[model samples]
Target: MHAKLGLFFLFLSLAAIAPLHAAEPAPPTANATDAASGAPTDAATEAATEAQSSANAGAQIPDTLEQRLLACAACHGKQGEGIAKSEYYPRLAGKPAGYLYNQLRNFQEQRREVPIMTYMVAYMSDDYLREIAAHYARLQPPYPAPAGGYPEQELARGEALVRKGDADKNIPACSACHGKSLTGMEPTIPGLIGLNREYIVAQLGAWKTGHRHGAQPDCMSQIASRLSPRDVAAVSAYLTTQRATADSMPALARSARLPIDCGVVPGASSADPELGIAVPEASGESFGKDGKDSKEPGS
Candidate 1:
């Protein structure tokens, strides 16, 4: 009976051990190379493999114009709308593509002073800039102009400056570089319509302070230097109040008639006959002058 009882206990113990052993999965077999090298695949290696596969599956150059626009939207905002007001990124939609392309090239060439833009554009080629410009130019302008309303006094001040020259200081009207309609000229200048007040103020300030410089002799600097802080604020206010419109097809035809030699009105210094200041030739062409002709060079 004692021998039988001892055998029974041993059997019980074996049964318990057998279940425990069977519950565990077998160790995976190693490849010959891995075994020879005494190394195993790691989590990082697996992750990299997955990542490469994902990249390959999704990778393709943007083929359509809309797809290509995604590159710009990454920074500028969806639909070519500007980033938030706090960020101070400029609106690109509705701007002349020519101006946009030139600005991009300027950033790439270090002609502009924005470190972020310079770095962003450093590797981009001219073709890429043109592509981006074309994309933004085709987009519609944003509604409710970025700088919507202003105090009555401010509007009046702005209107005065835009319409009439400050003759005492020889400050030509705002309508000079910006056309009577405030739309921009093709190839270089930008339209002022629908721009944010803050953007206008900042740009003028940059020009006045020399923080921003453009292609040699910086045309904006010449114009900006002549503006008082008050003048800057007023013009900006007025521009923001104007109606924003689509790029006029007729403007392109008018651009051909503009004088090739006309440059920004220079600071109060000796005037050069060769670089004619962009003042209006006649009172009839002035911004507030009595005629209904809204068409002009750089609106």
Candidate 2:
């Protein structure tokens, strides 16, 4: 009876030990077939998944047009007033939609030579350009002129140059092409009002330096070359200070004093009753007849 009891106790101990061993999970076996097939390991698969996630995040980094335009508002003002001191960015508000659209296209196509503008426009499409232009054009122009005062004498000088040609230099009055009010004529020309001084100076400088070339017989280039540094400064200063008045009359009159009926002739008026110029119907061969090809590269 004593031997049987001892054997029974030993059997109980063995049963407890067996359960302890059984509770531990078995070591996983590597499948030779999977290894031979060269399947990715769990760690590698995890790493790949993480890399893909990172790539997706990177791809989403560019801002949408609305966001970019919002960023533009900081420097350009809420309504595209343009930076007061920095003339590099022009006031986009109140510009003709077609003019704005062309400029945006020019920047994107590298026809315009501004590095910053090129980058800003690089990824933008035609539709995006039109949308941005339309948004800005619809905004009302800011009321009241810039607070800073411009020199009266300089302003007078600029006005004189713009209204009356410096015949000695063969420089025609800017109004000859830009119109009496300096607000550009319809369908092509752009206005000069509300522009930042820096932009005006830069554009004039570009024309003079050949950095901004236009198509054949570049009018701006010719005019810019004739202008002295003082003239550029004076003109820009004067223009920047002037405010557009609602009562201001258009530059051209119903009748002009030019000898020819051609559109290219200085002082020639437009025939369109609405244009107030006596300009003859444009013969199929006018300078800007081909709208797409009219502008010079980098204009």
Candidate 3:
């Protein structure tokens, strides 16, 4: 009995002195997470996996100018073409950079009253505006053929107004200031072609309502004021149908003086009707003080 007791004490000492070690690896994936606690390991594994996934997602999204442009793309289109399957969005691609720049500035300054545009541009700086404008101006996307049909009589009237104004109204032809083919003049005037009919109508209405504004004389306001609803509809539809010719591109230089003393034009006279200043009436045959005429090559 004493020998057995002595052997038992020896065994106990041996058990205590044996090098301590962790328990055998817990049963596979099921018990690996919490050997001490009574909980499943898979939940912890899933949580860790989720955390890793979140980190990867964060890493994938880096802030960039391209990211900022996404906001513009949402409304204007991915390429800034402004053709987003919507009627009101105009074709912004390949527009004159200066013209685009001015419009962006107008939106930001609230001079042009587009609520969405104003809100989007509220925080954009002048330099950023120029950048965005330049980006769109550089893109030359293909223009789709004009859509929708109008009455032939209205179309004829529209064409007449675009090419030759009604002599009775003292209004000059649309081509006189907007290039011979209804394209824009550099540094200010926008191209009339490749624009949505609805957009044109909307802008004309805005001008008529004094919601849209430009430089001192605001020639658009004056021009739109004289237009009847029929005239506006006719002109907008006609202009949209016409495509730009080689010469339809915006003129780089202000080669000729404006037909009337338009404040926005590069070299206009003091013919401010808005400021109570008297101006000369424009005629199809002749315009401005010099007999340069509205149909002159430079004009």
Question: Against the unseen true structure, what C-alpha lDDT does each candidate score?
Answer: 0.50, 0.50, 0.56
The digit string of per-residue lDDT tens for model 3 on 139-245 reads: 77666666557888989999999887778887667877776756665545667887766667767777777777776567777887888878888897798788654
Write down the TM-score for model 2.
0.59
lDDT of 3 at 113: 68
**Cα lDDT for residue 96, model 2?**
48
- Of 2 and 3, the candidate ranking higher by TM-score: 3
Among residues 3 or more apart in sequence or in different chains, the pairs in candidate 1 whose N, CA or C atoms overlap within 3 Å are 179-298, 179-299, 182-299, 183-299, 184-299, 185-298
Q: Count the backbone clashes (under 3 Å) in each candidate.
A: 6, 8, 0
TM-score per candidate: 0.62, 0.59, 0.67
Looking at model 2, how many pairs of residues clash? 8
Global fold similarity of model 3 (TM-score): 0.67
- Evaluated at residue 175, the lDDT of candidate 1 is 58
- What ranges in model 2 sit over 4 Å off? 1-68, 85-88, 143-152, 245-298
